[model samples]
Target: MDARKVEKITALLISAMIVCLSFSGEWDWQTVGIYAGSNMPERLLYPFFHTNMFHALLNSWCLLSIIFIYDIGIGRLLSAYMIAVTVPVDTLGYFTTMDSPTVGLSGLVFALFGSISFEVLRKRYYQLWMLFYLVAGFLFPGINAVLHLWCYVLGLIMALLNKPVKIMHHER
Candidate 1:
């Protein structure tokens, strides 16, 4: 499939899931939120839902930008997204003192950003921006900085492990 099609489809599907699930009350804290002792299903599904349309749209925009800009392959995009969502929940869910359910694709967005940062290390802004965002998120209310950090690390590791080759072309 074309990269453009994959990017559009991924973004559309994610936005659709958030919108459709929002109407069904799946965003309710008790229903689909991730927390310590939550079932596996809740941990897996919460990332596809969000607290509000604005939250969903913000995440969607970040997701779209990363995939389109990097031209991330479908396999890499899906694998990273799933890992970003579930891994942080399992690892960090036990450590949080939150009174509400956590939801959003910020982790996935950060993961992609991290991957891009690793793939193109000369562009230092990605790492710097991630650090700035993490600090900002920590100071903000209701933001999960730890999860973002974890996802970013996971993405960097993914890039390191894959070590994708970039073929350079020179004009004759």
Candidate 2:
């Protein structure tokens, strides 16, 4: 499948997949997201699934925004990246002081932000400084820094490795 098609449907498909999860009474991140106790299959579901409506919507919005603004380069890579993006984050979360189930699309969203920064800004200090403003959430309790950082790093890697499609500015 093409990456463009995947990008277009990603938000809807993932959002729909978790709607029934909300009604399934298994909304706990422990059951649906990645944690130390999570099996391999559950870990596979971590990046794409959400435990609540708000979380799902927030991620869907992020995904949609990236689809519209970013080139996404290759659609198939988007699918692979979406799934692989969470691995290191989850692994770090599981190993590094995450005593409870940590769940949210924030990591994935952050990854998108990171990829956009790396691919578009390309180490331009002026633009990269904007990333500092995103620090507020990092200080919040129950938020794992390792997971977010790792996801971001992976996103950067993918964006750089996959031939970044830097959307050129075209003034109307």
Candidate 3:
């Protein structure tokens, strides 16, 4: 399978899982924290749990859109990098807060904002778009605006420090 195709399929599967979570009503906000927190045995485990239907739907939409965009506009590696940054930040939020349950892919969305900002900085295009992302990050309600801000900052740092590399480039 082509890498891009795999990514698209993964995005769709994730979105499907989100829809399932929306209907399951099994995992609550606190339960999601347990799976996504820093104390986890592995970071890969966090993406499985969610808070509610709304949370799942919001994250699913954002993840699918971002992955789709990154896969096309940037590359598969960058899309994976965005997801990598997002998961840790999502977990970190759980660890940092005391009884404050964190859920959703808002952190990843913020990371996308950061990545886009980096692209703008590198290419000198989309200044207005970046500004709009910042505005959206701040203005969006019920979406961890603070986490988004921090993740954006972190993503900027990652983009600056790390050289772009293509991962999963070969077809499976």
Tens-digit lDDT string for candidate 3 (1-172):
7777887787788689767766876654444543344454234334555667777787788777767776433353355445643455555554344344555555655565566554544454554665666668557554455565666676666566654776777777
The residue-by-residue lDDT of candidate 2 on 58-132, one tens digit each, is: 766776677677765444335445744446544575446757666666676666666665556457772455356
Candidate 1 clash figure, as a count: 0
Cα lDDT, all candidates: 0.75, 0.62, 0.58
Top candidate on lDDT is: 1
After superposition, candidate 3 runs with Cα above 4 Å error: 34-38, 41-48, 72-99, 118-142, 162-172
RMSD of each: 4.2, 6.3, 8.0
Ranking 1 against 2 by lDDT, winner: 1
How much is 123 displaced in model 1, in angstroms?
Answer: 2.1
Each model's backbone clash number: 0, 1, 0
Evaluate residue 76 in candidate 2 and report its C-alpha lDDT on the 0 to 100 scale. 35
Model 1 per-residue lDDT tens digits across residues 66-114: 7666768777787777876576455676665566777788887878876
Runs of candidate 1 with Cα error greater than 4 angstroms are 1-3, 23-26, 88-95, 164-172
**Which run of 10 residues does model 3 get worst, by summed lDDT?**
34-43
lDDT of 3: 0.58
